[model samples]
Target: MWNVPSLEEKEPELVREVEWFRLYTWTHFSPSDTCRTYGSGVVQPFNGSAFYVRSNCAFILTHFTHNRVEYDITIRRGDNGLLSEVEIIINKVRTVLQNGSILVEKKSVSLPYDHTYQHVFRYGIYTRFKSSLLPLTVTWHDVPGGIDTLWVELEKEQNSDITGLCGKFNAEAEPKCPGDLVYQDKGPAYVPSCSNPNPRFIDQENTSSCVCPDGKVLNDRADGFHCVTVSSCSCVFNGRTYLTGETRSTRCQSCLCKDGRWHCSENSCPPRCLIEGEFVTTFDGKQFAVPENVLVFWQSSMYVQVQTSFGMKIQVQVFPEIQLYITPPRNHSGVISGLCGNNNDDTTDDFTTSSGIIESSAKLFALSWSLGACSENIPNPCINTDNALKCPKNQEFSYNLLACNHTCRSLSGPDPRCNLQDAPVEGCGCPEGTHLNQENNCTPRSECECHHHGGATPPGPVVIDGQQW
Candidate 1:
């Protein structure tokens, strides 16, 4: 038979079992906190049973285990008598945080080690248990004076089972210092960071400076400052950080940010004009309100005839269907502008108004060139409604074969009345290179009958101007 311990007797045992390890020599929450003098020595341990010191050299700082996971912390002192590096080993994995900068080595792989238990934070790393058990946090302050300090916090159930430089867990044991006291001013004021890597130091100053490890610079974001490599740096535009190789498009240019700079292309969008039924888009890309009496620029009655100053004639026909024929001159390649656009081969500025200003609205631009006010809105004639004009059954629909159709009548020579520049038109006439002969049939110019005074005459020649054959 065994005697059961009462709650009163077991309380101390349970309290001793749940031990908290807050490891740090300096108790200040921040490096900039007020300074105070304590027992002399390069290294110090708080709430620990014993403290030890060694000459400028590397040595194991502490060794502990929690939940079967082993943690080893080591420190190296430089020849200048300051902490040079602090290495932490969790089980088989190792990470070295060097002094002067907060640079940590790539973590080593360790099998059978549950990586989810560890978490990396801005200032340090922490490990958590699956249950609501307290976490073990290790913080490394990389400042000049604080670099020598290693911070660790853990909760244990068995305090008596622990032993190391951290000291015995029982409160009765006094902390013993093994080295002679040497109270000195905190080391240099600051550490180097990416933004200000080479910080200027003041002699005998107690201020702390921020720093980052080698090959890294400080990157500012909305949240806070982060250290990043040079190649990984991002570009900031309009207060926004843009990753490298990102692109942005504007109205006239396409820009990409590369190497912390913006590379842009020349004007990419050409001016355009659109004049649809109820919508009009100007050359400047602005849409204008449409009027009820929107004039039809491309279509006209077949009876309408146009005579251009540049020796071009456009004749329309209403028979089989509304058709307009164009007869262009061999000369005059450019120097023309209107609804047909400037024939200069460039279509960019086709909407130049009469005032010489390129207009963005087709309605306004066309109004500038209008000879008179447009008539009342007319119903579309093409819409097949009752009372609409119908084509004769015997007559076939006529389509404009070419803008410049050569007829047999023109075979004799150019018509003086139609000696106009080239323009598109449509009319009821024979196909190109054919003439209306005596039989009223379309015949090739080579097989066409002769004409006398605008009258079709048979191949048998007739007298003309006192010349007979």
Candidate 2:
């Protein structure tokens, strides 16, 4: 007889673990073309918001009219970035074709990298590998007018180190000094030159040296005499106090307060430097409000982060992948030097998959607004069994009564031993076809057959109903 479990007795668990050998998972450690099941292609944990993907360590910095690039890459297997005998598959999405291996010099093979945070490898991408060296050493080109598509994949010399990352000439890159580094000689921490897009400020004193209090490039005001401030306007000089005023600009722009405490031009709510709601007050006591638009995401982790935009910004991250049977993607195709994983404001591929599963790219963006946004409670799933037509069907219940006087278990929560068991109604015995047996079960049996005495007589099934008789 089959080993049938009795409903009244303990029922065995119905779920079984499944084998998922074919699913894929992405991580900080990139994967090989052939899926050898280890480390990201990157050697270190990158800092910027973007990087370039390439097949080799070389970067193409010059002009290229050609549409594609070809490189020979050899994969190195092992912690030391050594070459291995195994080969990997490279899937091409442009033409939907599988291409040949990226050879190292002239040979074809796979390489192994620890892909640890400290050893990430990256470079500028080349559709075709025949481009000349960069016009200027260390420069980026594939970037959109504003897009930062630098998350690239490339190979580097054996045992490469990322602590000493090199940056190329971003001709468009904001001149470091003319912008954020502009230390003002006035009470205001003026918006970066990148914001107001102002010209450089050089002091008119000391023979073509030092910056003028105002935002103007000045030549020699050279003399043995000391440079004097208007003595009414205030500006921060060398982290010290100084007064600035229009003494230079008809005192329109002068150092009214010389001790870096006040600005004479426009005093409409100064911008104070703040750290996490903490105010950094100077000894002289000038009040300023910290702009609330600033935000830091993924700070001091893979990359220290900062926001350079205005208006509303949001920061969110999706983790703990929910899909039980599928793996998320990590083989980022586009990377550039000094940038990785979607930091720029323009077009980016920051994880947009159809599956409900979550991945690293599942980040909550930073939305900046003058007035902060508020949060509300999330609604719970409806469980009104008495309401909808299908609600009763959705209501599922099953229980097991173990032997002995032990109570029955409930499925609701961690608390077990529910007491909802009610015995069958009194005198509502077993149905017609079944009868109580030695095992306390309602056992079913075959009907008794009758044969005629004569050998020629026919046998028939006994029936209690009039129609069957």
**Per-residue lDDT tens digits of candidate 1, residues 243-342?**
8789887556777876556778977767645432233557755655454333212221134444554556565655455556665544967567666666
- For residues 165-268, could you state the per-residue lDDT of candidate 2 as single tens digits? 11222223322121112222232212212112233456521111112345432211211112233333234443544333322222123334432244356433
For model 1 the local lDDT of residue 393 reads 25
Superposed model 1: Cα runs more than 4 Å off: 1-54, 99-117, 124-134, 144-146, 156-160, 169-469
Superposed by TM-score, candidate 2 places the C-alpha of residue 422 at a distance from the truth, in angstroms, of 99
lDDT for every model? Answer: 0.45, 0.24
Instruction: Give me the candidate number with maximum lDDT.
Output: 1
